[model samples]
Target: MTLLLLLAAAALQPAVEPQPSLAAKELRRIPAEEARQGATAGHGSVYAIGNHEIGRYDAKTGQRVARWDGDPAQFPHLNSCELDGRDLVCAASNYPNVPMSSQILWFDATTLKLRRTHSLGHGHGSLTWVTRHAGAWYACYANYDGKGGEPGRDHRETTVVRLDDRLNETALWTFPDSVLERFSPRSASGGAWGDDGLLYVTGHDRPEMYVMRVPAKGSVLEHVTTIALPTDGQAIGWEQGQNRVLWSIERKRTEMVASRVPPVK
Candidate 1:
């Protein structure tokens, strides 16, 4: 196979982790109020997370209650997260590395404790965002070329996949040309299932979210609409309560922003 083809083939293999060198740590403290990449609210608490750490806060008082720090070399690159029942499911990847690999990291919603790590054999793209919807799981596999060691990747190479409950791939969908243009070199950053039955997603740095839905008979998702967001980051969350607002973290500000999304027509 050609060099580019070889890389593409390697991307389909299972993710590999470095040898365990140090033990992961736990702390009952707060993370730096900035650098937050994702957020989720559940179990009477709110989680603010960065690529390096995760913090739990009281839902009402917003007071930091617990924290967990990942080994820098082990649990790096946590992008976005969503509350799956009592667990916080996060989409993580090894960026700046060639043949990007990814993992689905899970945490206990009440304690912010790491519970499980599901390696998503690097196939779809570079799993940037993942969420469960309608009895199935949906994931965004992102690709970055030129700057991120993926020189073979063009703007149109990214994709989203539907998986069974066991996380086995079932189908795949490519973003529309217009949405792919917004991603450019980077694929979708954040994704969540909206209350309106649409899959909402954000680009790496764009301050807008794209709404998409699986088509009845096609490999490409149907572009529904776009909504401006207050902040941008690598992942997004949707509040599950009656308010039903959207949540995102501003990595630069290290802060979380929430907004209400109008139901699609």
Candidate 2:
């Protein structure tokens, strides 16, 4: 009876299919000094990031508000962050060394203080970015042939994994080879779920973001579109309010920038 019920439930699920591409327009750039890794927006504030540091800023005025320094031995590389309710959840990894490991760092949204740490012991590359969608947590576990990733796995093996609220992976999807090829030696650096319900990913040092959706029949995610941005990619965030904007950081200048779909005429 249980088997019959399981099969019946599965039959009612919708089959996933490829989605069409769409373009995002560039709006403006915000000059900043703490955006070495990535940026995100929340609660009238913006968070600019470095590998081991994070700073809070006024979302409208771009003024520095607060900053937090992470321990090098524990939180060496903080690739990106997402605003979850009253908490800022960030992805951190140990890079430029063997046996790569990663963790999730949670911070208080108002105080910008480290609140908790959850380790995702060594497996499936380095955790680059994390976000929550439809009650599940999605994390990008990136790989590379370069200095810091898994030694044997090719850079093409990077994956995005969906985890339950407890951080246990439930489903996984890989990027299309065409997308992976664009990264060359490095792997995916940032990811976020757009307001349109598609997963947007950015490659290392590239000013492009790839749109992807999970396919029903395979482990590979379907490629939707490639949207251009102003700066080389690191991490990204999607602002879902009336602004409908996308945010990123220019690592070289430590600048945070924002872009949005052009307003309809």
Candidate 3:
């Protein structure tokens, strides 16, 4: 009789609603030989980022304007970049190497020349992506579970760190367990803050981007939803003036793709 009563009560409870699935509409694909790692857009141009190379192409004509190649030993792994004002701010790291170190590189947006570099030494995993938002800098530090991971830290250690103008850590937050599960064996390879006040991140090779929000008072970011992307994840950047547009890369095809992301409800 007690079992029957419990079952009746359980059936009366409300059902859990499944998370919504969203898709990005692919707008265009431009051939960018340097689109090996990630891509960003600004100043009527799209920049294709490689480990040690960057190719600037006219967005309208799809013509390569200029390219910059760096010494691999010096600028080993430039994971991602975003155009900031007149400079292209990039996040670089020494990955697949222990005691992971990272740095921030600033380059001339128009000239595609190395302007300056800020070494982050070795601390919060490997800096994979960084962007300026709401008067502060948000950076994603990647911690792998296998190849590039340290002895102790693994994928769970991947974090989003907020820093001041001088690049000093202000606060930090980890990903939720659900999101971490998707990043297992690897980590977040790209991230950016959306105008809707949500944070979007991508795993090493997943074709999905996870949307999250910083909890009111917690160390773990709250998972909002996942959006399907047309390309495998690496690094990404929001379109400069477009409300819901983003630029990403298709590594296998060596192309830079532009997509219009749907707004989160």
Candidate 4:
């Protein structure tokens, strides 16, 4: 009778679905002094992002073309950047400081000059990455466990917010448990919506990108798959005009690396 009951319980349990994995192929590396935070590609140029500086390099020649330096007091931590039309939209924050605050900085892609700033005053963790998808803006607010964390919240509180054209929050969602486990102490540092209609995000220092989708029934994002990358994560950007090419940074080497990411099945 005991054996029969155990067998019945096992039959009632759901079968575990295998998690799919994909590998990104490294394409090329470009040395950029400002590649400490992240990199973005657009308009025949690749921009290397630093805390308060940005260097634009020729994507084909790998030669430095233009550079922009901002006041560190105003722009302390520039986490990541993405190319949107004629501008390079960047995520900035006052990290490792109490009461985290974030802002969105836009620079002219041609001149590499600061064009505008929109302050997203303290509330939803440090803004790590932001991008536009399907006419809506998606932003990642990262909450760390130790250094840059707040009083009550930790990494588990990291969130993704959707905003309208004017940047008003419309909806919000959190990461899945499995993906959150990968970001235990440090939170997600980069995120972008892929052309394939999936969201790809990277953790603080992992050489992996989690492919996710907004769940139809919950406030948590669904983990669809994982992709292995060549560079340890800080911030990532998808190359403009390229199908599935991603641009990331090698912080230690101060280099910008490009990888061809495979499509999820």
TM-score of 4: 0.92
Q: Across residues 34-122, which tens digit of lDDT does each residue of candidate 3 receive? A: 99999999889999999999999999999999999999998889999998999999999988787999999999999999999999999
Query: For residues 1-265, could you state the per-residue lDDT of candidate 2 as single tens digits?
Result: 9999999999999866323244466766666677888988867888888889888888878788898987888778899999998999999988766688888999998788999999897888888999999999999888887777665787788888999998888999888987887776898998988777788889887778887888978899988777767779889987647466888887888788888843221
Q: TM-score of the candidate numbered 1? A: 0.84
Q: Pick the candidate with the highest lDDT.
A: 4
Q: Candidate 3 — worst ten consecutive residues by lDDT sum?
A: 14-23
Q: TM-score of the candidate numbered 3?
A: 0.92
Q: What is the per-residue lDDT of model 4 for residues 16-81, given as tens digits with 9 covering 90 to 100?
A: 733438889999999999999999897789999998899999999999999999998988999999
Better of 2 and 3 by TM-score: 3
Model 2: lDDT of residue 131: 90
Q: How high is the CA lDDT of each candidate model?
A: 0.74, 0.83, 0.92, 0.92
* Winner by TM-score between candidate 3 and candidate 1: 3
Model 1 Cα lDDT, one tens digit per residue, 53-129: 88777766767888878886886677777888888888887875667788998888777789999888667567788
Candidate 2 similarity to native, TM-score: 0.88
* Model 4 weakest lDDT span, ten residues long: 14-23
Total clashes for model 1: 2
